[model samples]
Target chain A: MIEVNYKHKLNNFLLDISFTMPDKGITVLFGPSGSGKTSVLNLMSGLGNDKNKKINSRFIINDRVIDDSINRIKIQPWFRNIAYVFQDHRLFPHMTTKQNILFGYNRCNSELRPEVLIEKFKIKELLEHYPEQLSGGQKQRVSMVRALLSQPELLILDEPLASLDYTSRQELLPYIECIHKELDIPIIYVSHDIKEVLRLADYILIMDKGKIVDQGDIADLCISQPLLTQQEGASFILEARVTKIIEEDKLVQLDCGETILITAESMRLNDKIRVLIHARDVSLCLSPPQDSSILNCVPICVDEIQADENGKLRVIAKIGKQTIVSLISHRSARQLNIKKGKQMYAQFKATAMIK
Target chain B: MIELSPILVTLKLATITTLILLLIGTPLAWWLSNTSSKSKVVIESIVALPLVLPPTVLGFYLLLALSPDGFIGHFWLYISNTPLSFSFSGLVIGSVLYSMPFVVQPLQASFEMVGKPLQQAANTLGANSFDTFKNIVLPLSKRGFLVAITLGFAHTVGEFGVVLMIGGNIPEVTQVLSIIIYDHVEVLEYTQAHYYSIGLLVFSFIVLFVTYSFNRKLMVRL
Candidate 1:
């Protein structure tokens, strides 16, 4: 686990934050712009320390005290064994892509061969080319390879996809996923995009201004967060595993405490995935509708029903232990006679969420 | 035939002076470009003093400093068995000081252009300051080095007042092209003065033309 507690005076507010990120998955620092998310990453990398002001901070990564103000111990950035992938992909313009990727590998004396990374990132064809000649997605890929070849214990990705277009962002997401699955290195990813958080985050830390307002698993946080549900269209993630593929109907069967059907043909069996379901896309019924077009109709126990300020009834329910929310009208809740501890069925259009 | 001794002496002095300035001014320029210390302004002003000061003012001090009884001349005499006054080495010292800003300013600007982002990236990649400078910064600042060398050599070749004050008109040793031209004009040898003056002008034009053309090619690659 990586634990950090930092308190520094920014121009607008006192940036005070403390949290422990899981050591084996993607822990996303999520917030709006100007919310001090990038500042947290900078502090972890030991990049921007004000010489004039004494910054009080304590950072420990898996029992190593990387920084401790009380003891006056601070490791330099080079020796900290932490690698950073910046948003701008700060590649050396003078070096070829091959040389840029080998920069950290040579310095760290890493045993991880550069050929393995170059092949994995799929930059073999562009090795001889300079950074200026590569596309945005290609540059980001080279940067990731550079960071990984350093053999760092922790990798910090500070909005690595924020600058890319939609197509390039889609292209780079799988490479980031590969880093977590293939390498098993812990990553601290900072982003303001909720869609990215829903797709990539295992643990989420929500920040406002400069303080961490909440932190928990992304699935639980999305369902329980009032600030999240009150937004225009709130969504929650479900941890599900693909059980069977039905190619005739172009659908994949998922086991999320019940047999949930989604219209996705690209997934393979036994693959674990997170399904992002929006509240407005879900509707509750008194009984399981048999003749409807909706493919996913899972039986859930009603947990609670609360009235939002906008006169819409927010229904919270549970499928096994996982929480799911639905935004319906008060008349509909009254018509269905939904209440706490009552059994009900949550129906959602499979095509609305699946591609 | 035109006497080539003064031209040869002038070339030798400019070559040695450019080399010395590069050796000392490179580190100084690098430091001035990167330092945040409050005393940086003081050092910068000192390096820039020769630009605004009258050449005779600088020559007057060198005359006192390089005299046999003066501080530098006495120290030199004690160590090398030779007085600094009127020697070729004395002319070199004066030229180095006179042409310092020309060498240091371009270097400083180029170093600044290379900036901190690339250096920080190198540091994260485990390169220390010196290694980063050698591998990343020096190669990128090629244009700056070219401009500095060209300007330093040309300015040293053109120096007159400082050399006149300290050189004492020694033959083939302290008699550079500019000093020889001055002597020709004094003795009404108009034809001789014209030959040397025109030669210096053409030589300067060719050197500047080649450097600018080469610098343009370097910039395209950068």
Candidate 2:
């Protein structure tokens, strides 16, 4: 477990934040630019050392005190064993790719095998090349490997893919996901991109104006923080696994405990994924629809009915353990007599996003 | 033809001065590049004073400081039983201070050019400050080192005013190439003066050319 508490006056705002993360998972620090997201990362990693700026911080990772302002027990970044991947891939310009990766591996006395990461990140052929010779995405990959080989107790990635093009971001996402899957190293990924949060976050911390406004499981935060939706309104996420692939129809079937189908590509059998569903796309029916153009009509029970600020109504419903939301008119809510514990079916097209 | 001892003495003084300057200048330049303290400007101004100050003015103060009765000279005389003024050692001290900016400025600029990002990256990868400096900062600043060395060495070799003021023109000791050429011209020996003058001009050019060409070929990062 890693616990962080920081209070420092930045040029724009007062950065007061306190948060704890699990022993191992991707804990995202999501916020807009200048919201002190990077500042928090800097404090935790011992990178925010400006003698002019006063900071009172305490960071404890697994019962070990990494820093404490009151005690004056400040550790330097090198000895702290916290690795950071910057937005720009900060590979040493003078070193070859092999030397860059081995730099940390050698200095940290890391027991992790370098050959495995080099092969996994697919930089074997690029070993002899300098950072200038590689493409943007390739440089980032090498940087990730370099950070991982250091065997950090915590890995902080400050928008590692922000500088890449759309295709390069897509290409690099899996490599990041691979790190989460293969290693038990606790990672704090910072980003303002909604898609990245939905795809990569295991837990979410929504920061606003240097404060964590909301935080919880990604599925819960998705429904609560409208910013996580990437759309204009309320949204929810459905945890599902790939069950079947219909190549001829360009469709994929998912087992979200209800076997939902959506169109996507490049998925394997039994691969876990999250399906992002917008409340506006769903229309609630009192009973399962028999004749409709919609393919998904999952049965759900109304969890809550609240009036939206737009004079419409929002019906929060539960499908087994997972929750889905619906946006409908107040007139429709009255006609259906929508109330808590009311059984219904949600009808939405299969055009929902698959992550 | 030009009295070999003066040429030999000049090369020896320049070589020794440059080596000492590098050893002293690297840390000074590194501190100047990385520091954000209030004294940085003050220290920078002091280091740069020699660049604009007349060499004779610097030589004048150096002559006092190196004299047997002066503070630095008093302490040195008590320890080594030797006077700093009119000796090869005194000339070295003058040349080093005179050429301070040539070595330190280029090194500081190169170190600044390497930037803090790379050093931070090295730190996160478990490198202490000195380790990162040795492996990352030094290699990237190859051109800076080359320029500094060439300028330091050449500037020391061409020194005339400070050496003349402090050296007292002792043969086979402090009478360097520039002083020997001055001696020749003073005695109306224009031919001997021209020989040493042309040799110096060609030597300085060759040194600069080789250093720059090598610097370009080395693929320095900054």
Candidate 3:
């Protein structure tokens, strides 16, 4: 686990953050712009000055103190066994792709070579080219490979994908996901985008101003608090394993641990997919409707109903063990007698399951 | 046709002055680029004194300091049993001092432009300070070093008043190209002076052209 507790002031922003991340999963530092996410990464990498009384920070890998300010022991950035992929890529402009990759591997104390990593990232075709010749996605991939080749115990990605377009983000997401799954090394990802955090993070740390206001498993924290709920739309993440493909109807059945339903697409059987169900796409019914055009209908138990500023009620419901959120009028909810433990059917269009 | 002896003397003086300036001015420029001390401004002004000071005034000071009875003169005389004034080595010292700013300023600017990032990157790559400078900083500032060398050589070649004060117009030894041209002008030998002056002008122009062209190329590359 990586434990951090430190404080520093930059201009008008005061950073007083403390958190511990599991050593084997993607821990995302999520926040809005101008928050202290980037500063936290910088402090971990020794790129910023340390302040406060004996700033007690430690990157404990298997119980070893890599950095402990109270003990007056701080390992240098080079020796910290951590690799950082900056937002801008930070590729050496003067070096070719091969040379840039070799730059990290050459300095690494480990015996692992860079050729395997170069091939794994699929950058071999562009090895002779300079950074200027590569696209944004390609540059990020090369940077990731470079950091990985350094054999770091922990890889810190500071918004590495923030500079890419939607198309490029799609292209790069699978590669990052592959790295997260294949490599045993832990990754600390910092981002302000909730969509990305939902997609990649197993653990999440939510920051406001400079403090970590909330943090927990991505599924729990995203559903339980008003933090992720403030995005105007109802945000819910559904983790399901594809059970079967009904290609005749152009639909795929997903078994989300409790309910199995046909989605709009024919995804490969047994492949796990995380689908985002926006609250605007869901409608409520007192019972199963006999003849509805909507393809997705599941029995749900009302967990809570809370009123918004517009006198609208946000209904949080539990479908088996999974929680799904929906927005409804307060008057309608009161008339329908919707309250805790009420059994109802939540209907959504199959297309609402974002791939 | 001009004699080969004066050309050889000019070449020797340029070579010697360039070498000495490179040795002394490089470290000075590096220090100036990195130092945050308050005395840096005062030291910078002192280094640039030769740029505005009349060459004759600087030359007069050198003459006094190198004369037998003067402070440095007495010390050198006590060691070598002869004054440094009117000697070949004394002219080299004068040229180095007069051309100090030309060699140091470009180097200082280049060092500043190299900035802190590259060095820090190298340090994190397991290179110590000196190794970082050798592997990273020096290669990155090659253009600036070239500019320094060219300006130092050209400036030393064109020095006159300081050389005149200290070297006393001696031929085949202390007589450099500028001094030879001065001698030609003093005797109303316009043709000889024209030949040497044109040569010096052409050489200086070539040096400046090369420096500017390389600088432009670097900008494009960057």
Candidate 4:
């Protein structure tokens, strides 16, 4: 685990935070712009600390005390073993792809083989080309290899995909996924994009105005985070495993406590995935609705009923142990007489999948 | 027939001056580019003084400083038992001072262009300051070095007023290309003057032309 306690004065606010993040999987720093997210990263990585002084901080990564004001121990950035991949892809313009990737490897004398990384990142053909010669996605992939070759104790990705177009970003997601799956290095990824957070984040830290207001596992916290995006309604993530594939309908059957079949033909059997279901899209019925257009209808026990600001009723229910919320009207609630512990069927169609 | 000694002396002086300026200017320009100190502006203005001040004006003060009784000359005399005024060494010191901005400004601008992002990137990649400078910065700033060397060498080669004040017109010791051309003109040797003058012009044009062409190609490659 990485333990961080930092107190620094910013332009408009005093940033005081102390938190611990899991040492494995992708822990995302999610926040709006100007929320001191990058500042937190800079403090952890010891970047821009020469100018950003008067910082009272303590950081211990996996029991290694990287910095401590009380003990007066501070490691310089080079020796800190914390590598960073920037948003702009800070590749050396004078060097070719091979030279850029080997720059850190040669200095650190890392045991990680360079050829394996070159093959894994799929840049063997472009190894001789300069950074300017590569496209945006290719450049980011090369930079990722460059950082990983350093064999850092921790890796900080400050919105690496923020600069790419939709297509390029889509292309680069798998490479990032490969890093966490294939390597043991803990990553601290900073981003404000909800799609990426939903897709990649195993743990989430929500920030606002220089404070970590909330944090938890993405699946557990995904339901309560109405702040994910203002444009989209509330959504929840369900952890499921694909059980079967129905190619005739281009669907994959999932086991998320109950059976769910989503229209994702690419998913293979036994593949674990997260199904994003918006609360508004979900509707509750007194009994399991038959002969309906909705593909999903699951029996859930009503756990609670609460009135929302929009004069609508938010019906909370559970399918086995997993929770799912449905936004229903007060009239529908009065008609169905839904209440706590009442059994009902929840229906949602066309759910998004993160595989 | 043209004498070879003057050409040889000029070449030596320009070559030596360019080397010294680079050694001194690289760090100074780097410091200038990266520092936010209050003295940065003061040092910048001092370096740029040669660009605005009359060469004769600077040379008059330099001549005093290089004299045996003056500050630098007294120290040199005490240390080496040789006078600096009207000597080859004095010419170099004067040329370095006169060509300060020509070398420093380009180096400074290019170093600034390389910027802090790459340096920070290098630091995180396990390279210390010197390693980052040698491996990451120096190679990236090659164009700046080229511009700096070209301007420094060409400016020192073409120096006349400061060379006149501090170096005088001693044959084989202190006489450079510009001073020899002036000497030929002074004696009303119009033929010799044209030969040397045209030589200096063509030499300068060719040097600048070759450098700019090379610079353009580098730009395209990048």
Candidate 5:
């Protein structure tokens, strides 16, 4: 596990944040820009100083004190056994891909070699080339592979995909997911993109203005306080295991305790999928209408209703204990007398379910 | 038809001077580029002092400093029993001082352009200070180093007043191309003077041309 509780004051910004991340899977630090996401990473890597008196932190790899500020102990970045991949791929221009990958491996006390990592990252063909010869996505991939070659205990990535184009980001997303799944090492990824947080994060830490507002498992935290109500585009994260594939209809059946039919393309059987249903995309109805073109109409009981910024009412419906948000017009809500304990059907088009 | 011995001597002196300037100027320029210290102004003024001072004045000071009774001269005499005045090494030292600005200014500009991100990246990548300097700073500033070397060589070769004051025109020892041309001119030997001056001018032009072409290639690649 990685624990951090520190505070520092910059010229005009005050950064006081405390959070802990589990030792396995991807922990995403999600926030808007200028929310001290980068500063948190820098503090962990020893690039910035923490000036708090009670700053107790540790990255315990089997009970090792990698960082213990309370005891006045800290490990240098190089010896901390953590790899950081910055937003921009900081590839050394003087070195070839092979040399860049071998740089950390050369310093590591372990016996892992660069050739194995090169072949694993599929960069064997580009090993002799320089960073300038590759594209942005290729550079990021090489940097990731270079970071992993050291066999670090933890990996920190600060918006690694922000600089790439949309297509490049799409191309690299699966590779990041693969890294999280293939390696047993925990990862702390910082990003502003909610879709990436939903896709890759096992645990989410929501930060704003240098403070961690909330943090928990990705599924539970997505629908809770401050994350769902305060965030503009916040939605629910449903972890569904694929039960069957409806290949003829171009749909897949997912079971999150309730069978959900998603119009997802190119999915294999029994593959775990994460689906995000934005609050704005869902509507509530008193009864299931048969003449509707919507493919998803899950029976739910209205749990609560709250007014949004524009006075539009958002009704939280609980379908078998899974809370889903549905935005309804105030006039319709009033006419339908939608209130707490009202039975309703949460209706949404199958295409609105994004993975 | 012309004696090429002095031409060879000039080339040798300029080559050695340029080498020393590069070896010493790179770190100086890097420091100047990154340091926020108030002493930067003083150091810059000191480095640039040779540019504005008359060549004869600089040569006289150097001669005095390297004289048998002078401070550096007495120290050298005590250590090696030999003064540094009126020798090839003395000429090299004088040339480096005279052409110091040429070598340091380009390097400073290049170092400034290579911003902090590259260095910080190297620092976080398990590279120490010296390794970062060798790997990131040197390679990124290759064009500037080339420019400094070429300009320093050209500037040193064209030096006349300093060599005249200090070198004493010892043929095949300290007699460089510029001094050879000056000697011919003083004797009203216009043809020899013209030949030597033209050769020096052509050499400088070639160096500058190569510098510009290499810079162009760098721009294209970047």
Candidate 6:
């Protein structure tokens, strides 16, 4: 676990935040601007050194005390074994891409092979070129390779995609996924984009006005704080395993609570996936609808019903042991008499967000 | 006939002064660019004093300091047992002080332009401050070094009042191009003065032209 508690006085606000992150997954720091997200990363990486700013903090990573105000033990950033990929991709302008990637590798005497990262990031052809010659997506890819070649215990990415256009961002997302899937190093990714957060985060820390408002596993946080996701629709994720594939119809069978059909492509049987079901896409019925053309209509028990600010009722129900939410109109809830402990059938079509 | 000794002496003095300024000015400029202490302003003003103050006024104080009984002269005499007044060594000391700002300002501006982002990036990438400065900051400041060297050399070559007040026009030792030109005009030998004046003019123009052209090429790659 990586634990941190930090307090700093900014010009307009005081930033006081504390949290512990899992050791080996992407824990995203999500917030709007001026939320002190970058400051947290700086403090952990030991780059928050300014003469006027007095930061009182304690940061420990896996039993190693990186910073402790009480003990007066603050390691320099170079010695902290942390790699940071900044928003601007601050590549050395004087060095070619090859030398830039090898900078940290040569400095730390790292045992990781540079060629492995070079090939993984697909920067072989761009090695001889300088940073100015590469495109934005290509530069970010090189920056990631540069960070990974150091073999850091933790990696920090500060909105590495914020500067890129839509096409570049789409191109770079899979490379970021590879960082977590192919490599075991823990990563602290900072982003305000909801789509990036939902796709990349295994855990989430929500910040507002320099404070951590809430944090938990991504699935729980999405339901608990819908506003934090900032996505247009309320969505909940379901962890399921693919049981079969009907190739003729381009549909995959997932076993979440029961056999469910989702429109997905290139999915193999036995592959685990997370299906994002938007609350608006689901509807309720007193009995299973026959010949309705809805692919999924699973029996569920209403656990609770809560009124939302939009004059709609968010019906929380259990399909077997798994939780699903449906946002339905209040008039419909009154007409159907949906209440706590009510038994009904929830129907929806699953959209595969990630395979 | 034109004596070549003054030209040679002037070249030698300018060469040595430029070399020494680079060695000392680089670190001083680096510190000035990066430091936030209040004392930085005081040091910066002192380095810049030569830019505004008349050269004769600066030469007069340097003349006092280089005399046998003056503080710096006494220290120098203690080490080498030679009075610094009117010596080639004294002229060198005078020229260094006169040309300090020219060398340091360009370097400081260059260092500032490189900024803190790249250096922080280097630190996080496991490079210490010294390594980052050497590998990153130094190479990126190539244009600054070029400007500093060119301006420092040219300013030292054109120095007249400081060299005259300190070196006293001694032949083959302290005489320089500017002093020789002054002596020829004092004697109403306008033809002799023209030879040196036009040569200095062409040299200065050529140096500036080459530096700016070369800098433009370097900028494209950067």
Superposed on the true chain A, the predicted chain A of model 2 yields a TM-score of 0.89
Which one wins by DockQ: 4 or 6?
4
| Candidate 5 error regions (>4 Å) | A47-74, A94-96, A109-125, A225-232, A350-355, B1-5, B112-114, B216-222
Which tens-of-lDDT digit does each residue in A1-355 have in candidate 1?
8999999888788889999999989999988789899888878878774567668899999999988999998888787888889899999999999899888888886879888888888999999999999999999999999999998889999999989999999899889988888887899999877777778888999888999999998888887766566666678778888899999998888888888988885787888877888888999998888899888899999998888868998899998888888889988988889899999999985431221
Cα RMSD for predicted model 2: 3.4
Better of 1 and 6 by TM-score: 6
Worst 10-residue lDDT window for candidate 2 chain B reads B213-222
Candidate number with the higher DockQ (3 or 4): 4
Residue-by-residue lDDT tens digits, candidate 3, A134-197: 9999999988987888788888898988999999988887788888877888899988777787
lDDT (C-alpha) at residue A228 in model 6: 53
- Choose 2 or 5, whichever is better by DockQ: 2
Model 3 alpha-carbon drift over 4 Å, by segment = A49-59, A111-113, A232-234, A248-250, A260-268, A289-293, A307-313, A328-337, A349-355, B1-6, B16-104, B108-132, B161-169, B216-222
Candidate with the larger lDDT of 1 and 5: 1
Q: Residue by residue across A1-355, what tens digits does model 6's lDDT show?
A: 9999999887789999999999999999998888899888888888775457787889999999998988988899999999999999999999999999999998887888888888888999999999999999999999999888888999999999999999999999889988988899999999988778777899999999989999999888877785653356768888899999999999999999877999999887798888888888899999998889988999999998887877788898888778888989989999999989999999998876553
- Candidate 1: count the clashes: 0
Model 5 agreement with the true structure over A1-355: per-residue lDDT tens digits: 6777767675557778877789889999998898888888887777654444245455455576767766867776666777889899988877899888777777677566666667666788899999999999989989998888777888899999999999999888888887877778899999988777777788988898878998988878776655545566667766677889898998888887678888888787887777778788898778888888777888888888887776678788787757788777889898888989988788874331223
Cα displacement (Å) at residue B36, model 3:
5.8
* RMSD to true structure for each model, in Å: 3.5, 3.4, 4.1, 3.0, 3.8, 3.0
Off by over 4 Å in 6: A226-234, A283-294, A309-313, A347-349, A353-355, B214-222
Worst 10 residues of 3 chain B by lDDT: B213-222
C-alpha RMSD between model 6 and the true structure: 3.0
TM-score, chain B, model 1, is 0.94
Report lDDT (Cα) of residue A60, candidate 1.
Answer: 96
Note the Cα lDDT for every prediction shown. Answer: 0.87, 0.87, 0.79, 0.87, 0.80, 0.89
**Candidate 5 DockQ score?**
0.39
Task: Give one digit per residue, the lDDT tens place, for model 5 in B36-148.
Answer: 77899899888888778899999999889877787777787789876778877778878989999888888887887776767766656666668778878888898988888
For each candidate in turn, the TM-score is 0.90, 0.91, 0.85, 0.93, 0.88, 0.93
TM-score of 1: 0.90
